[model samples]
Target: MNKLILSAAALALMAGAATADTVRMGTEGAYPPYNFIDDDGEVAGFEREVGDELCARAELTCEWVTNEWDTIIPNLVSGNYDTIIAGMSITDERDEVIDFTQNYYPPTASAYATLTEGADMMGGVIAAQTSTIQAGYVAETGATLVEFATLDDTIAAVKNGEVDGVFADKDALVPFVEEQGFMFAGDDVPLGGGIGLGVRESDTELKDKFNAAIDSMKADGSLNALLVKYFGDETAQY
Candidate 1:
């Protein structure tokens, strides 16, 4: 009887271990304030904290991994990652490819310019990464769009006069130019969208859990607290 009872307990322990929830989250660590690496080689940013909170709420373990922004979606689809927690904007175009949790961050677009003067460059030559929402804006506004592989290169093009302006996530670009003394042309251009957590199409259960967690965080003001921690109180409006 003792031997049989021991076997049953061992089997139960194994099943519990196998069912433990784990959420593998991907992010573009290059985007500071949103997702970035710290001096100690730890992933530290608003998104990272938010991911941790969500995992706790859902009773899961989160694994953070840095991925190139452009390849994030592909990696999720290929099962290289379970979800994307980067500062990814939700758009009709992207909805066709993967599922998204309810918006965790509001999306806003802005332009950075070297001249800081007259010229509606929103319709002129603008630098952006290919297949990004910024690139879509370039297409819609008929801007002569310059596509680059990285944000640094695109920002460099703006500083070098290769492009009239560069459009990107307002949160990501504003603090950067302010620190670097690069001039911004206009007020915060409202893209009037929202950032979402991306999940594979087959992972609807995980997506639902994340959405619930986000809602709970928003209600408890934890989301706003994180925003202020990273972007300052006034700039945390989004």
Candidate 2:
């Protein structure tokens, strides 16, 4: 849920319930380890596995659909998909436009990754994906915020010296720091409530079904296992 503006009440009038035989699950299939396209040209990531299980538990037939992250919520409102299973953090600004299930992913921290150690994270130019919480934070916290369409672009910015560092999910940045020689420049910044499934307000039934599935996963400890599977042992769990 990026920078969407429609109110939930208005969106309720625009979007219908999931009346199709196959519910379309929307995602930005670009953010690795969360949701991303794989070698076989299919959506394959933590969200994909979790979504399939949720659909099975809810007895809902579901399929995946890819969309640009910046427009994912708006397209949902326009009836492009039935649910958003992307790694979208629940926040009040987004809640105003769409409904969210109880968090499936635990709250995590955002961090800065720089090419060199001890880069001035707060005072120097920073890159973050457009319409993301990290971008908003950079814009508000006095850093010159340069945003891109994809997470890869932000990382490239850091590599090419286009910016001082890239601010993004710590989990998402770990691989770059360890393998690409980028160094974390500052303390992690905890933002958002947690990650959840997004739906139009009118689809209360769909929301309830996903929430129940998430609850069952949490109760059974399978959700934590999946989190650990993708994010490693140090990842925060339920």
Candidate 3:
């Protein structure tokens, strides 16, 4: 009789907690095609679209919140937001601090953008956004790593010759390479598992809901359509 009572109570708690509150989707609104602040000063990008759909699928009310990339995780942990839907790659190092849902974006490569060809990739001074995987990789490559608060600063460092190269996501570098004539230096370095929604470790129920939504999108092919829509035809799909 006691065991039956406890189980029923647990189930009741779970039911009541479903969609408990409005989930705040946190992101760095500077990474284009992922998340960005548009001309109207509102969050507008692939992540905004995906996040809204996920909330609908999960039956949760949601809101958008933008934060600086360097402080995004800390603010999430501090309850400034409920989830990190930014284009954040999952890694073992970060997983220690917070929990991640199943990957939404596929694994991609980090590349070096230099003004000239044949720039020394391994030993050259490189600029990368602070607190990023690219910054960590640059520090490990026997190169002097210059950290910047934003991606634009890294690209500017490259143009002004403050650094020999700037290392970042290949998708992000594509525009500069095509328009500004920055050439890729050295081989592309594959890093991280993939991109995922991040939530506090204690928010397992919230995580599960998002995981289910991602699975649904992947199963129905809507996720791949979004990828191609924002990242172009050649981008890796679900």
Name the best candidate (by TM-score): 2
lDDT of each: 0.80, 0.92, 0.92
Residue 138 CA displacement from its true place in model 1, Å: 1.2
lDDT of 3: 0.92
Candidate 3 per-residue C-alpha lDDT over 1-238 given as tens digits, one digit per residue, 9 for 90 to 100 = 9999999999999987774768999999988878889999999888999999999999889889999999999999999999999889999999999999999999999899999788887888999999999999999988999999888999999989999999999988988888898999888899999899999999999999999999999999999999888888998898
RMSD of 3: 5.0
Q: Which prediction has more favorable TM-score, 1 or 2?
A: 2
lDDT, candidate 1, 126-149, per-residue tens: 888766777776778767888987
Candidate 2: regions farther than 4 A off: 1-21
TM-score of 2: 0.91
Worst 10 residues of 2 by lDDT: 1-10
Give me the runs in candidate 1 sitting further than 4 Å from their true place: 1-20, 236-238
The lDDT, on a scale of 0 to 1, for candidate 2 is: 0.92
Error of 3 at 42 (Å): 0.8
Q: Candidate 1 or 3, higher lDDT?
A: 3
Q: After superposition, how far is residue 131 of candidate 3 from its true place, in Å?
A: 0.6
- List TM-score per model, in order: 0.85, 0.91, 0.90
